[model samples]
Target: MSKNKAKKEATEKEYRKPLIKRRKPNRSIAGDIALYLFLTLVAFVMAFPIIYAVSSALKPLDELFKFPPTIFAQHPTTDNFSDLFITMGKSWVTFSRYLFNTVFITAVGTAGHLIIASMGAFVLAKYEFPGAQGFFKVVTVAMMFTGYATAIPNYIILNKLGWIDTYWAIIIPAFASPMGFFLMKQFMEGLPTSLIEAAKIDGANEWKVFSGIVMPNVKPAWMTLIIFSVQALWNNKASTYIYSEERKTLVYALQQIQAGGIARTGQGAAVLVVVMIVPIIIFVFSESQILETMASSGLKD
Candidate 1:
């Protein structure tokens, strides 16, 4: 009798349920289309500058320098790039040398910044130490100021230490970014304390826990730090500290080319396009990781 009753209820439940999932309403479909259109418009607006740079770089001299300039190229050619190489060949410093300097500075600075900032974050976010609160507060306060604020004093100290005109002036100062440290600290705050405790119970030291647990977990934060460090170091002209053509960054060299009259404009646009590539690549990968981390975090609004 109980089996019959259960079978009857199951039959009724199956009868009430649909075999297929319901399709979304026309209103929902319309909303999705509108959202995608809006996003597409926004993306185009943000990308216009880079697009224009590449277009202008490929345009013939006549088209690139037209009155009330155009956004699209008329006669696309590689003359601008050829001319740029020719100009570089005539200059005292080779173009590749400038490229190498910028690459070295950016790579070293970004790596150093990630290590220093993440370590600082671990200490401040996880550990209990005297003056830790005050130290973090100082870091927070320092974030209110940009790198420009310290340029004068930084130059003075570097001059005293003879790091002036050396890569140390850029690399060492970059390692002490307050904003990166603070950003990492905030990201680390979301991490679980239990993991660290468990690691300690397993007889792991601070370094082991930091390397094995904290760094792996905070991949998004450090990736974001990489973007910040690269942008800063990549754009660094530092004309004040760096005087020689040998030490000057690629962007600075490009800036000089861009400052020339209409004749150099095509190559200038080429330079701009090249300079923008690395940052865009960094941003694309880091953005995906950051989004993934945020989704998995399961934080409530």
Candidate 2:
């Protein structure tokens, strides 16, 4: 019996030996170190501009163009920001108004795009109506056309509607986003039909099914759409809300700083840093929770 037990142990050890030998314990550690090194390098590369901007913004005016280019401010101060807000006076008030205008338009535009695009995509993906394919083809074609090509027509339409120099000129044109519809439609096609069918059998109407069943299942896609839409509109410089000085976006505001005079170079840097960093920080923090959920949820259907 003791001999049999010893033989069994030897057999088990023999079986386990191959797995142990095949396992490269240090390989995983090496891979992890390599990945971290690459990411650190990428982080530094991406962060350098932001770091430089912040340093420039904080540096004293005399040190702004000091030779050799300091990575850190020699003497940090908020004088640039203060001058931007206080010395500019009336221009500062206009800037604040434009900032608020941009925020409102972007938020509303993003929400509207998500709702309208999702609904349109749902119909296109699920229902087989007359000319459905043709309609989708038209949407695809529209997406292929650059916004610049339609800028003249859009300007004409806005002018015809007397929307020039108003918030509507900015917010209204953004409502019908072809790319957004296409993205939603593609995402919707991946969802299981059985979910919609089950909801229908349970006496849920199309609206109820779409809002409850469809939206919940595609949270990741929706979040992605929201992020993209926000970024696009927030950074937009074209159209310029009818080119009015008072009704410009943050981008236009920064442009004004340069147009006013290149002498305000440090102030321009401060404004640019503030405008760019604020949206990026907001987007990162807001989307982080959604991204965590998306990661844990896995890509399974």
The reply for model 1, stretches above 4 Å from the true place, is 1-43, 66-70, 291-301
What would you estimate as the lDDT of candidate 1? Answer: 0.85
- Give per-residue CA lDDT, model 1, range 32-128, as digits (tens): 8999999999999998987898899899999986889888897889998889888887889999999888999999999999998898889998988
| TM-score computed on alpha carbons, candidate 1 | 0.82
Cα deviation in Å at residue 155, candidate 2?
Answer: 1.4
- Candidate 2's TM-score: 0.77
Stretches of candidate 2 off by over 4 Å are 1-46, 238-244, 286-301
Which candidate ranks first by TM-score, i.e. highest? Answer: 1
Each model's TM-score, in the order given? 0.82, 0.77
Mind giving the per-residue lDDT tens digits that candidate 2 earns over 1-301?
A: 9999999999999999988967865568679899999999999999999899899999888888789889999899999998887544666446677677678778988898889889988999898999988888888889778888988888888889999888788777777888777777877787899999999999999999999999888776677677767777887764544566566776767767757666787898788786777567756766864464344332222
**lDDT score of residue 71 within candidate 2:** 91
Clashing pairs in 2: none
